[model samples]
Target: MSAARRRGSPAAGLCPAAIDRVRIRCPQDVRRAAEALHAIAMDHGMRAAPAHNIADKHTPVDAEGNNLAREVFGWSDRKAWCGNSRIALDSPITAACRFESEPFWVNAQGFRTSLPNHYLAAIDLANFEARAMTRAAIVVPVHLPFGQIGAVSFNPLDPALTELDDLFALQGDAFGVYARTFVASYEHVMGSLQALTAAARLSKREVECLRWAAIGKTDVEIGMILNRSRATVRFHVYNASVKLNAVNRSQTVFKAAQLGYISLAS
Candidate 1:
């Protein structure tokens, strides 16, 4: 069957031709998958960063200790991009990823997306190139389980090309599909920790309680809002905590936010 006909099948988002190239069943598959993605990106005048956890300071490497950033994209100084420092905290690209799940592009002016996000507009872009270290880029944000956000940036190999509006229009969707597939498969095979418990599913009531709790509603307040007794509200929250393997009410709410059951945004 054609790739489109195989939608929703195993490794659905990946192209049929790339399915075998990018499947990550072992450690070595990570590098193989990354190379497959790199070849596609280079065709569009871009370089790829296969996987990056926005919250992490260390650059992602293959299980064989190959720095994908350095080897794939030729970024020599890993520290300048990411390290035991606050670069992620200070990066506007990282800030944009927190609020956006779709693909977007950035330049010295600011972030550009299909939809207008006030949150992205609010970020400071005074030193855009200095912070992001690229004249411009098309970034795909991959929000994962446990609230982990990964990103793949396609930067123009040409230094003078600071705008990507036309290129984004032409190949953005293709890049989004490929980027998400590579990052998600890489994380599935290479991630060190299990991101969720088997019974982490929350019911509608549990989700409602956590959503209210995330906004700082006390149990009594949430009970009043939901028209349930205070004791009932407490029970649901506690049940959610048990399901999520969280220690306390706060962690329970946080985990729910991570799992996308609750939104932490104001």
Candidate 2:
């Protein structure tokens, strides 16, 4: 079926393919976006399931060691394989990011045998679990600055839907575009929210220091601008980093921007 015709499916309401641009701001929006991507896959005669994002490296595992996929996508009859697997650390989605810094596809066969050569034997047990749970996976890697890395993954559930190879060959670029756009929008909103929440605790002096830093001013230069001693400037910057949970000056500035506390353009 043609992409447009396939998108005519009612499920496409969750992921309207005709829309050229969108701003996804919440989980519901994400689900809609995911659904749309899945529709795109189906348009190419691929048997597909709902699309979902894998948890990033920063996401914490649960007490039972479950990742965000189970929670974010929520549980459904179609999601049994994911919930059964329970862990994300060595799953195919994560491996897609590990094996390459770019978007990639892994089929059932690749799931069974793909691994770093050095740990082939030692990692066999982990690989076995992944192979069993994930029959096929297409991961679109999103790499952002300051060590943020993640992916949007599509898992085909219906046994009848099995054109993954052909889908990748024909529509991979389109899939990557949708995945990248969604990931970027998600990160922007969440990062802003997190920064805003943390920025509330920042002192006035800290904000000043970070603003100057954002504009490329050095500690000594910032001191000159503020008529404070260099040591005092450094102290405020350090304190700001502490308050922002940032590891360094650059991160402090970046966090401040994320929170809308400072503008880099100025």
Model 2 weakest lDDT span, ten residues long: 1-10
How much lDDT does each candidate structure score? 0.78, 0.54
lDDT of 2 by residue, 1-266 (tens): 11111223332233344344434665446545444544555555433332223442233122333443344344343434444444445554554554454445555434222123332223333453244255565557677643456566655655444346554544455556666666666566444344324225777888888888887889899999999999999999988787777889998888777666777774
Per-residue CA lDDT of model 1 for 54-88, tens digit only, reads 77776667887888778766666743464326767
Off by over 4 Å in 2: 1-31, 45-86, 111-132, 158-164, 190-192, 196-237, 247-266
Clashes of 2: 2
Question: What C-alpha RMSD separates each model from the true structure?
Answer: 6.3, 10.1
lDDT of 1: 0.78
Give the Å shift of residue 14 in candidate 1.
9.7
Clash totals for all models, in order? 0, 2
Please report how far candidate 2 places residue 54 from its true position, in Å.
Answer: 4.0
Candidate 1: clashing pairs of residues = none
